[model samples]
Target: MTAAERRASGSLAIIFAARMLGLFLVLPVFALEAARYPGGNDAALVGMAMGIYGLTQGILQIPYGLASDRYGRKRVIALGLLVFAAGSFVAAAAPSVWWLVAGRSLQGAGAVSAAVTALLADQTRDVVRTKAMALVGASIGLMFAVSLVAAPMLVEVIGLHGLFTITGLLALGCIAVVFWWTPPAPVQHANVPRGRLADVLAHGPLLRLDVGVFVLHAVQLAMWMAVPALLVQAGLDKDRHWQVYLPTVVASFVAMGAVFALERRGYLRAVFLAAIGIVLLAQLGFLLAARAPSLPVLTALLFFFFCGFNVLEATQPSLVSRLAPPAARGAALGVYNTLQSLGFFAGGAVGGWLAKNVGSAGLFGAAALMMLVWLLAAWHMRAPQTPKTAEEVLADEAEAG
Candidate 1:
């Protein structure tokens, strides 16, 4: 990789990490801590408060990414960060669950993942793009671990409000990094054909992966609605839940080494489907945990969940990037993130509604059902062929001629 590529990847990784740390911090505690507010007693409302961010994010990701093409990546990103920071502060000051929902909605409105990813893709070559994306992924994985440790402890210090304050500050810091540190993007992104969104939307493999991401994230947020309480029932205090999370998350990362090993052995499709199956298994485990709520049982289930979650998180975006045309990469990813965000929204809102009416049994059962559908669809997915740049395609055409 070139020096500029290194700088871009590193800078973007840090930016993503900082923003995600804020989100991850809330996840470990929000289901439990949200009850402290006035409207928080309503499980459905609490779910809304937790998941509204995804709704706003899903609504605007495509528009935001397209805007960056006409506008500028850094400028749009900075503006987005400011909006996120505002949302964070708003959440920090939220008086009730309703206000918290509004704040989370505003936070989602700052959908910058598409722009950030497009910016990184612009600066890096296809050959190394996976590694760059993986850097971003690893940073996020690290943040998830850090938040698991920090949130339970910190929530005790300043509560969710303080975490939101820190979240806002992190966004402010990211804005500075974007403007000053990120490498200048290549002009090729603009020179290339501004491909139609239909081309991306109509893509078959891309659509399959999109559905998979949606289900994956939906189940992710949905499960949290009950997991924290189950942990409490298993005799761990809310604050000490990290004892389970840190080890499970860490161990899960190690287990994912086998996933990569399987991929290297030419079983990409098999491994991909298996990962979904693993997630499904974990969900069923959660369903049983809803009955018994044993600490050791819950701990093992979490390990399986993290293992599946991490593998999916790393694979899907990279696959989308590989499958889409370079010129239309932004649009493809926008569509991907949109579904992902909506899954988050559905998970939170629907999960909350389900939990309120049917309890954790119904919630996990629904999640497992979604995964089953995704696994079936994913079964037909073809392994992605490594894509060439515009230059490579043109050169090949000329050579053939």
Candidate 2:
């Protein structure tokens, strides 16, 4: 990659990581901590507080990316970051669970993920785009691992309010990085076609990928609705939950490496289907183990869950970037992310409801059904083409120019 490509990819990856860290950091502690707030003890309201970000994020993701395509990437991103920072501050000072929910909704309203991703695509050549996206993906995975381990420790020192304060500060820092270090957006030709939401919605393969992401994240949020409480019930202290998470996350990374190797060897479709199958099985495992609730069994189940989750998380966006029409990449990704956020909202709301009414076992069972549907959809989906060589990408660019 060129120096410009490296700078753009590396800087944007960190920015994305920073944003995700803020979100994931709260997940581990929110259920227990929020109970201290007014109206926090209501399971439904707590779930809404946790997942409300997804509602606004889902509503705005496509509009933000579409705006970026027309207006400029950095402008949209910077504005979004400012909004995010404001939301963080709001949450930090919130006196009630309802206020926290409103704050979380505002955080989602920023909706810059599609814009940042579109900017990465804008800055890199086709040949290097996948690798750049992979770097971003790996950073996200790393942040998630770090958040699981660090959140408990950090909460011990700063409390949840302090964590929100830190996240707000990080957003301000990301805004500075955008202005100072990020690359300029590429200029578009007057005659080049811009992507339409309607077109993206109509595309079959893209729709499939969107559904896959939706199911993946929904199941994830649903599982979290129960997993932390399960750990505590199994005799692990909330502070020491990291012992299980840290090891499982590390093992999942190793598993991801193996999956990536298989994809490189032309087993993309096979591996994709297998990964979805594993996710389904893991959910089933949770359902069964929910009855007995043993630490060893839950820990084993978590390892399998993360193994599938990590691979899917890394694979989905790269696939979207590759399969999207060159002109409509931003819109395509926007739709993709919109569905993902919707999944988050659905997972938390529905999962929390299920946990409260039907129990955690029912929640896992529902998640398993969702994955079973995804597995079938994935089975019919086509594998992405082999990535172009740098020389080939350059030749194509030369011809287009």
Where is model 2 more than 4 Å wrong at Cα?
391-401
lDDT, candidate 1, 334-375, per-residue tens: 888889999999999999999999999999999999999998
At residue 391, candidate 1 shows an lDDT of: 73
TM-score per prediction, in order, is: 0.93, 0.94
Among all windows of ten consecutive residues in candidate 1, which has the lowest summed lDDT?
187-196
lDDT of each: 0.87, 0.87
User: Considering only N, C-alpha and C atoms within 3 Å, which residue pairs clash in candidate 2?
Assistant: none
1-46 per-residue lDDT for model 2 (tens digits): 8999999999999999999989889998988889899998888888
In model 1, which regions exceed 4 Å deviation? Answer: 189-191, 258-265, 387-401
Clashes of 2: 0
**lDDT agreement of model 1 with the native:** 0.87
Candidate 2 similarity to native, TM-score: 0.94
Deviation in angstroms for 369 in model 2? Answer: 0.4
